[model samples]
Target chain A: MNIGSLLGAIGQGFIWGIMTLGIYITYKILNVSDLTVDGSFATGGAVFAVTALSNIHPTICLFIAMFVGGICGLVTGILHTKFKIPAILAGILTQLGLYSVNLRILGDKANISVAPVSTNITFLANVLNIPHTRAGMLLGIIISIMCILLLYFLLGTEFGASIRATGNNEKMIRALGVNTDNIKLFGIILSNMLIGLSGALLVQMNKYADVGMGKGAIVYGLASIVIGEVFFRRFSNFGIKLMSSVFGCIVFFIIRAFVISLGLKANDMQLLSATIVVIALAMPIFKENINIRKVGKINSLNEMKQVSSSDEIVKEKIEKREVTEVGGGNNA
Target chain B: MLKLKNIYKTFNSGTINEKRALDDINLVLNDGDFVTVIGGNGAGKSTLQNVISGTIMPDFGTVEINGINITKYPEHKRAKYIGRVFQDPMLGTASDMWIEENLALAIKRGENRSAFKWMIDNNNSLFFKEQVAKLGLGLEDRLKTKVKLLSGGQRQAITLLMSTLKKPDLLMLDEHTAALDPKTASLVLNLTDEIVKTSNITTLMITHNMRDALNYGNRLIMMDQGRIIFDVAGDEKKKLTVEDLLQKFNTTKDAPSDAMILG
Candidate 1:
């Protein structure tokens, strides 16, 4: 692909990276695959479009869109927590209902174009004397960093630890006196707010918000998260993990741009995104299976048994050593 | 102190496979009482603890802690006064959390968790390290280690510490060390005794091991088919032996299982 197109793809990737971060909150941290993004994403863009058209300041429009997205998440949360609906089903219900809600927000239109140079990204470019693509990328980087910092701070807080614990072990957290339902609601709301913000940014950059723009958005978000995780597997830092989602999205778009440049149809990109997620998800399992096959090829049964048992013994010895070293350190 | 008055629970009430888990049960625990419960499979031992802990609401009864009736309290709401360690080592802890984080959650039990406060401060970390050091497992320095990496015995010990960290009004352990090897089980059981004794917390621990039931606590109750068939405490419980418990089991409609005999 040409350098210009590659840069444009990277810019789009950063904008969508915000949405991927939103999905990461639900998908990775909360351990719930919330389908509400398909609906909330479109809702975000539509809210931003309608608000920006009213001569509202572009920055304020972004917050408005994010608030509207949180409302969408609240609906899903209520359906899941209060009504006792399954989380995935509740997300689906909200997503399906959002289609009509999005249409209503769009003034009963299928799409609205903000293609005029007065749109925020273009305005930013004009103000800064930079290209529109460059302005979009700059905005994406700024917002993504702010989001990462905010999440890192919040997740380190007491309530945030409870939220993470709720996702990890609902029964255990509940037993420890956390209201898991409330924590879940808060998580969903925070997740969708970021998603809505991403949607607004995407509309600003693309110059249009279509009711169908969020179709299969979950797959794209998952693809970004999965790809990012595959690349940054060794880092356990939460901030780095969050940044990886954005990085994953940028890489995803770069690959897509290159693939499109190879004369692939745009309609085929959804299939490609789904394929990327599947491969990333299965990569660890595939590695394990290959290791098992290698072990199976060992001609001696004693060596095979030793391979399995020796690992555990070695791990135990290492852990024992570490504990003693720490104890010794305290004594000295 | 805890009280269970006229507690009754039935599973699959109308079905052919209907089973009465707890029937017209009544239990009362005095302050500083540590009760060990033993029973055969499906003897409602777990059901009794579940009812007390609000895991399952009794059909007709009231659970009172310090004379405050909590019959309608949800499990999480009642967690403020009650601490529980489950049979499975994995169930009592969030496996992905650090040891210090788990202890932090434990310390915050029954208090409103504020989003503004940092969960792990240096003070609490120091306090936790000191508390863990008392376990004598060399885990005091490994505060940042995730719980999943710990052995079953270590996990149970950590869980025991977490359950008692806040010094709840009541502690309930449902076979907390049953999954460990004999040596580990004994270690955890001794730790349980030390923590309970030091805090003087009211506790109800369930175990399939008859010897442990007899050896650990000041009171022992044997259950059979949804009712407490025998209750002994104080000097009487202290004098009871495994043979006495076996003879008592023989008097029931069903004989003791090999596991109980081995114990």
Candidate 2:
């Protein structure tokens, strides 16, 4: 692939990695299928583009985007937990609602640009006197690293434990006297915040935000998480899992870049992602079945041995009883 | 102490499949009271425990712990006062979490806010280790082991210990030992008795085994349909046999099934 194309792909992939982290938080840590990603992704981009044009600092604009994303997540959590809506349905409702809200945020435009103003990464890149591609990559890497560190610290906290427990087993966590609704809300908010921030960064990197930027975002995120989990299944440690997820996103991007270089059409991206996720999800089930078959064979062998041993024991008991009877007769 | 007054629960209300899971159930458990509940399938044993634990809200009732009415309280809100162990060993604790981590969570039960530190203090860990050592299952040495690695009996033992760690106002055991082998079940039951007696915590244990129901607990309750049909205590409960229980059940209802008799 050409250097520019490669760098462009890498930069885009890096931005997408943030959304993967958000997906990891909701899907892996919280163990909930949140569909709010589609709308929230665009929401982040719109918020960032609109805010940045109004003379706000680009970093602050990103923060505002993340905050809006968190609000969207909070609404989804409220719908699911307090109102007793099914989680998937709640996400769908929120996503549907976000479209109109996103339109309003964009002032009825299908897409918007912050080209005339100081874009976050471009400004930073100019100040640093670095090439746009290098600047984008540098910015993406630093933000991702910071995000990962923040998550690592947060997950180590007590509230984080509660959130993890909520994912693993809500009933057990509730029994621990945790108001799980609060934890769910907290988790959703945090997850969407990262997602929105990623969207904001993408707009700055690409020089514009579009209404359809979030399309297939969920699939992309799922692919990353699945790929990461498949790669890190052997690690029992939580820290390892987190690292693997980040690596998974990067690896997914590299693979996508390779596919594009091989002359695959852009439309094929969705199909490839779907296939990857299917394979990743199916791997565990395939392994489990293989293990079960092995155990079943061992159990049958043990059963046969048990049957023979019981029969031998019964025969020995009968002979002993006969001998005792004969000895008693002789004594008499 | 725990009290349930005129509790009524109907599942799928206003439907063809409507079932009155609990009806006019009035019960009071004094501190240190270990009650064993027995019944056949669909006897409302689990429903009663659920209501008390706030998993299921009673249609009409007042559930009070130490005279505090928690009838309107939600499940997570009521968790502070009530400790519960489910029939499925997997349901009571997070399988992926370390045994110590699970213990830490149980220790923090009822706390308004959890501390930020991941590790408990050395002294607290020592105390938990001591508590775990009492199980005599060598779990004290396996405190760092994930709970998923433990056997059903071992997990149940740990769950029982965890539930009583905070000495909750009321403890509910929903056939917690039913999933284990006979030997392991008896061992857990013995541990239950020792823990309840020593801690002086009020407890409600549901069981499918008639012999266990008769052999354990200070009070024995036999539920039929959706209400308590028989309540026996003290010397009467001590003198009771499996045969006596079978007869009572037969007289109170129809012919008791052989499987019910066996359990």
Candidate 3:
């Protein structure tokens, strides 16, 4: 209810934003579901917690966490590409495998606490010479911005275009002389690494790493991406879109804070989030059907196609566009 | 030069869906031959192109391009040596990408995609504009427009441009104009002829339209049941009429569709 509580939510949102940005690479750009986020997120936290306790530099621990997360993605990529497993199932397999791996990393504990001596909170506050209340928000903003800028630049590169093309038309790009399998592998790895990095940072903000911390991470990530597209889709610039993903999390957290202040129990949060996501996802489909009925003249077949290669969410958008196109045919 | 010797392929082998997509295909093309192929659906026209391009491996064949045996190369790896345009307009280009971005991707078709290179080089923008302008679709002015907005005819035109941009060692067109309207199909065919002749790029084009297959290439080949039923070139090809070709096709139980044979 208070400003402090709201700021705390924003801090949490920023960390989630970072993870979604990682999701954005796979879900939005590469067009892969990459369900490895849940497992990779926990791996990152576990790795970060243990490394930070051993007094390794905080920044170095973050890199280590990211690398470990990337390896998880690589494994999923191999399972999908080399072993011919479906992408989502490949990610689920890795996620399930990482459960045991996460236990070992946590020294068989379900949770590990990084106490007051940890380098993430108070240590960061001392370095910045600011109060603990303000340190997290400031760090979150700065790091998120840095991550955004990096993504903006990378996606604009030739290789980045190839990644986008891979999601868009795997066969076309393949005919263009790109080994799409390798491109897919790189995309999955990069996405998981970013998720891992975000997970490591999220644990520090909470001052603890729990085995279950990453549960429903994909839902959270997808919610942020869908919300960002819903609210800020007007801006097509890659950088602004990336910022919008983070901005969406901030808005979502703020909304949660308002709802909680209105007397909603904390236990209802997950249910509320799930419902919101369901609506966000189905809104396009429902709208598309409505448009079809409105037109009333469309044929059974209207040249719609399954060409976007991947991204279940984007596939919905494709259908939405097809129906809209049918209605818009006369206007054009 | 391109060569295919003893290429054999069977899909869904030993099943109810079993099909011999390719059967002992042996072909040789000297540089800049500009051949056209015609066949009905399931005639293995696409399979022959796919085998040469490595889209599908031949069961028993050595595909040699320019005297190098490239049967073992993957599809993308073979891309450095060939250019291809598919029948479906959507299959040849990425729709969501900008007109120029698609060209930039084609420009890097055979090169290693570098992380540091700008996606579309500024220096090449003018060249792209010129190339797009040459399409005469007014696409030059709208280089930044997503390809999705382009009409089927316009997309086919750009796809043709992309295929020949590098003067590929061999250019393959698989019914590239079938999706276009009559007027646009002729326009694209003319463009295809212009691009092929100027570059002198050895090319193979497949068409259901009998006239396009007969008129567009120096050599004309017909396939039926995965076998090249007829092959003719130069004066012999030029003298042939649509009726003669249809007559040749009728000799086989499986024949081209009436619409295609009569086109």
Ten residues in sequence with the least summed lDDT for candidate 3 chain B = B254-263
- Stretches of candidate 1 off by over 4 Å are A116-119, A288-332
Clashing pairs in 2: B210-B263
Q: Per-residue CA lDDT of candidate 3, range B138-243, in tens?
A: 8899999888888888988998899888779999998899888899999999999988998899999988999988888899999988999899999999999998
DockQ of each: 0.44, 0.35, 0.62
TM-score for each predicted model, relative to the true structure? 0.92, 0.89, 0.93
Q: Report the error of model 1 at residue B212, Å.
A: 0.4
For every model in order, the TM-score on chain A comes to: 0.86, 0.84, 0.87
Please, what are the lDDT tens digits per residue for candidate 2 over residues A1-332?
77777777777777888888898888888988999999999999999999998999888899999999999999999999899898899999999999999999999999998888887688778999987777887788888888887888777666677787889888988987898888888888899999999999899888888988898889988888777877887887777777677777777877888888899987688899989888877875575556545654555565647775555554454456556555554343
In order, the Cα lDDT scores of the candidates are 0.90, 0.85, 0.86
TM-score of chain B in each prediction: 0.98, 0.95, 0.97
Top candidate (lDDT): 1
Provide backbone clash counts, one per model: 0, 1, 0
Q: Where does candidate 2 chain B have its weakest 10-residue lDDT segment?
A: B112-121
- Using DockQ as the yardstick, the better of models 1 and 2 is 1
